[model samples]
Target: MAEQDGAIYDRLTRVPERDWDKNAGLDALLNGAREPFVLRGFVADWPLVQAGQRSAADARRYLLDHARDRPFTVSIGPPGHDGRLFYDADMAMNFRTGTGKLGDIFAGIEASEAQDDPRTVYLGSIDIPAHFDGLDEANPIDLGDRDPLHSVWIGTRTRIAAHNDFPDNLACCAAGRRRFTLFPPSQFRNLYLGPIDNTPAGRAVSMVDFDAPDLAAHPGFVAAMAEAQTVELDPGDAIFIPSMWWHHVEGLAPFNILVNYWWRDTPAWLGQPQEALNHAILAIRDLAPEDKAIWREMFDHYVFANDGRVTDHIPPAARSVLAPLTSESAGRLRAFLLRALNR
Candidate 1:
């Protein structure tokens, strides 16, 4: 019985196989239509290379030059911190702002560039041809981009602590091997996040001690650690991290080059009035302890419960809202949300 139980746990916790099924899981999660999913080896087409290659050098140069041209923000690591940022070119300039300063910056860039460029990182969208060479026959996932998605992340090793992004990210290592410690969105409680007011860098938190973690201090973290996944990415090896999954990245090597695609499984509702509700929550309701507590309870009631339990609460009138869970239901819910939101 013990051996069988262990096997079942392993099957549930181990990374899923990289295949269509897993990809479906990722797509479902990104669409907010399903639970967390793991897609392994989804980016096997990316070619890996060592640090000395010209491709790596070119990527680094492009990143630094782009960052220099733009008013990019930077986070300098304090002394004795494991954070260090270095670029092959001296053109890389550092910009530091107080917490929450970069929010407007991120909003502005996304507004102007038609792409997400939070954290002052240079992100080349996936539709540009300059980024992908042999993608024609690669059976690539159609992310509606004519160009290959790429980005250059230049930051101190400890600059970005830990957080999750809204869109699914496929990051390719070009110059350095970054050690990524990933936790599913379900582990958010264990992370102990910072303030949400901080923009670009949102809700900073460290999942584990760099040198030593006091397990006693955070007992819940032990379960989080048990479910934690680690990947050391070298040049050419890309990691497909599902949307909203918490991650901490340590730049194991200097001049780290990373190209990534931030793709959403669903279309974004731009210029929607519903955004006002989000703003109101952040600006007002979130401040009141009673209101916040009520909101938290609502989330726990509707969002955190198992699918079986929560699905029952979804009314037939709102059944369409739950249709994202399956392809058969997506159209109904999509239309419903679109109409309901008047978007």
Candidate 2:
């Protein structure tokens, strides 16, 4: 991340690009992709893309016209930090957020763009259907039975630290140029993660600065770099990021806008894995080694096994929680956990 910036970018594998027209629909493509891929000119026909292609002003107008005139949250990062929205020395957020109409926010962003070193202005994870009127109908991807959480991201030139999310992402660059540096889920140990609960965003992000990583302090990052995949997306290009894959994003253009879809492969009622992790940390993390080992064996038997070892001992009707979980069973399990934790 020092003298090796160009080398790192050059050595990394570019994310493969696919043709959306030539291939199957989005859901099918995603089901097969298992990894991140680019779709060049995927949404070139969309009104949003055409508007942005004409001018950023046109794009802003298009969005404002479609928007419901509701106040939207914007993240404003102070200048002098190289446009990176991260933390200060005290681990507090480096950016302040305020809500404004899209037009006002875009005006502020435009003003900032004129500055030599502009303030980082970002509007992230905005629910498209809730705030925008008829845009979802006008510009839509056929996700085919998968009702994803459609969202939009708007920002000036900025850097977002590497982070993972629970739901897989399909990110479409509606306006401006953007670069993504992605790492596999296995690179967890090398990414030098920040505090889990107190994150800049909801998801935990890598503490390492991609532009200038301190390799000596974090030697494992070198291994992470070896596995990195970097790709730059132009307007109308899209990328598929598998759930839990670490990604560092850069808004290359002065004004950038992205539309993304997020959804889990698992059903909604199954419960969040992160909560289970927190509960495990509370219950098992500090246990004595021998006790921990026993608990690990118990977990393997109960939660993480496929040998039919559990069912071999129990009858069909008696295998209540052990059986395939449905919405009802998951609800019951949550209720049981709450009662147990409270006791």
Clashes of 2: 0
Global CA lDDT computed for model 1: 0.48
User: What TM-score goes with each of the models?
Assistant: 0.53, 0.95
Please report the candidate that would top lDDT against the real structure.
Answer: 2
Model 1: pairs clashing at backbone N, Cα or C within 3 Å? 83-158, 84-157, 126-147, 126-148, 126-149, 127-146, 127-147, 128-147
Q: After superposition, how far is residue 165 of candidate 1 from its true place, in Å?
A: 1.3
Q: Can you write out model 1's per-residue Cα lDDT over 70-114, one digit (the tens) per residue? A: 233334432333342222124232334332222333343334333
lDDT (Cα, tens digit) per residue for candidate 2, span 287-312: 99999999999998888884588787
Cα RMSD for candidates in order: 11.8, 1.8
Question: Which candidate's TM-score is highest?
Answer: 2
Range of the 10 consecutive residues with the lowest summed lDDT in candidate 2: 1-10
